[model samples]
Target: PQLGGPIWADPIHDIEFVQKVLSAVSTNPSRFGTSKRIEGMLSMMTEELPDVPLYYALDHLCSTVHCNTPAMLQFRSALLHAGYRVSMSHASRNGLKTDAPPGVIWDLLRCWEKANPVKRERLSETSPAFRILSTEPTLQACFDVREDANPQSRKRHLVRFQENPQANWGPKARAKDSGGISSELEDKRKLCQNKRKNQVTDASQLKNFPCKRFRKGTCTHGDKCCYSHESASDEADKME
Candidate 1:
């Protein structure tokens, strides 16, 4: 069943919680919900995903300099539109070894430098083409330029490395920062983990057991117990 509730602010963590709940239901069917009709429930739930993450940002790792720089430039422009500043660098292929040496940015830069010597000079000028670019969302702008102010229509591929403004620690920092998640998926993961931990082991599996939570129909922790059946019943009634 689609159990609707208040939307969690942190969907990533909520998805984990839901997963844990489902896992608990699946493994401990007798203790939690009955297993007789669970398969259909799971199938339906999987088929009709109401919410999901669309565009997740991740650090694009360039392992070598052999690859082209134009692709990276295009990526930078796209990210810029989507609100991300990026460091620009080009790679050279003439002197590049079949295998680029590990642990260096210059290796990539040198390759591009060889390919586009003119671009390198432009980058080095007082007004460098490669820059730390950012467009502020200022409500009251100090200056506004006409659409045809420059009188020169520029091509998109012109700007290469426009470093990300928020990334202070460079590639390492950016890589560490980016993350992705959907709330529903995360909730479900948590439900699964809890189920696994509390699962009845083979040694005790064959034994005819009483309700796991209430030791002789009485929970030791009373209201604080996570597995307290009385509390669960109250919760179910409240939900209904």
Candidate 2:
């Protein structure tokens, strides 16, 4: 019935259409473009496909209470001790994803408070911390660092979290009618640029800082490492 080219009589679903496009591009590579061009097209199209759901579900645990790195480590250790799988969530730096129940998590927090001892005057009677801490822990939560508490991502030194490429790098207000950034924002950007570079000019300024990994005997970077591998007493002696 169609004259100029092929025409579709029936409607195709979104997923089905995507699959059809993928199949057509893959089968007729020469018709598209050069090898590199076709490869790029395929890659871009492939990214549009829906991601497969994870086999095991993870419960996101965003803590209301302030927790430093050591506190977070202690929490992870406690969770591991309680026979629950735990890992740092990409959603938040301080947040953790765990399979542990709400009760278990609350019990662990109570145990941490008992071990660290928060000042009674600081916590209000109506506060969640006070309400949670008042109840005795149902499970025995240990704060001791377990071997498995440190995740593989940290051990591997993978680039999991990205540092800001430049100061004031996030979303900005729409450009002015003049098609340029505001004067205030531009001035702030200029001031922040090379801020870190200017802070430490001399190489010696970085030295004598004790490497935590080296102290723990887990540092893979040997003598070439910039951080000092010497003990605290040795560093003190060096200072003298």
Candidate 3:
């Protein structure tokens, strides 16, 4: 005898499993209404389904350069319209992972630049933006949003890229030693401060006494030597 309760079936080899499950739940509301587990399972299956590939094939598109005019949504829409699969990369908040070729990506960027014009005079001929904009796109790009432009994860409100847990959460400055003691290097730096500026330049202003190191032929300061390098005989002649 078949049970009266919900009969769970594995959606093996069923490409429309998600749609079928949703339909069944909607039609037989009382059967699934009492079960939170069923609801959560369906949610997970629909929204949390990972996009896996046999191998790493998608191209990563990220840049440190401050070109924020072309939003991710705009790029996604354009790529979708051009019949290419595109998604946000986990590596960066604004990064894109797509199967689209470099040429097509550049073309889309060119289209975006044309619509939202930038200061042409500011861009140099050698700059990437200028070079990309100079060339005409091979394919005419449409920024119209397609039904699939927005992924299921986004639509279901799944946590894609997590926000910063706390304010200013990133790389910090080097930690100082405990007890607020200044380091030996810092003490040495303080001692050496203004040493070059305080150095006497005029030979006449220098002390007539010869440097002991200069007499021993071991003085390293050369012309910048603060002490006089004159011999005892020269000093005696000067005294005379």
Candidate 4:
């Protein structure tokens, strides 16, 4: 006995329920199951004949459209009005031809624009598929063909970036989770200071260094590394 809300709603389970009713002959039969709720409900046993009731069943209604365009919602509404159970699924642009029939595509766009005037303009304007369709006639009839003919095709957009991508922290800006540049600089500064503070000093180390070049900030080897080494050498030489 499937004692549950789902059994009352789903149409496909009606036959299964009937089969279970016919098979269970004993008052207290062991029913193996996964759901704890189902197991607990099935544990109910009665010596007297129990009455079970059948309610409504569940089923999904759906429909398909050609092109899988942005005007899908509008098109779905039109089909629904014309007594068709329809729903839309996203498709890929690689399969769709660049030039689709203007009439059908335009009709879909018109209906979409009417229903959602604010969003219709430039909705698919910059899209690759739309751009190709707008300019080329070779693939004009592609959009007119029903999705069943070629179900995998869709419209998509491609964008290009010329500069380092700007991270637009909008009006409500929060610090990035990544430690900031200041924190990194501070860490580096601390590391440098610690390295200098814990530096080992010996007479052999002092003798093997160039002290003069670093004092004027012009060490021929490199500016940054040379400056620090030369500064240390100069201090050591002064001490000597």
Worst 10 residues of 1 by lDDT: 92-101
lDDT for model 1, please.
Answer: 0.34
At residue 169, give the lDDT of candidate 1: 32
Which pairs of residues collide in model 3? none
What's the TM for model 2? 0.42
For candidate 4, which ten residues in a row score worst on lDDT?
A: 56-65
lDDT (tens digit, per residue) of candidate 3 on 63-153: 2112445555767888888987776543445555566777897787667667766777888888766776788999999987776666664
Q: What RMSD does model 1 have?
A: 30.0
On TM-score, who's better, 1 or 3?
Answer: 3
lDDT of each residue in 27-72, candidate 1, tens digit only:
7778734452443333223322124211112122221222234343
Every model's Cα RMSD, please?
30.0, 20.3, 16.2, 22.9
Which pairs clash in model 2? none
Give candidate 3's TM-score: 0.44
Which residue ranges in model 3 land beyond 4 Å of their true spot?
Answer: 1-67, 167-240
Q: Candidate 2 regions off by >4 Å?
A: 1-69, 166-240
Q: What is the C-alpha lDDT of each candidate?
A: 0.34, 0.61, 0.61, 0.34
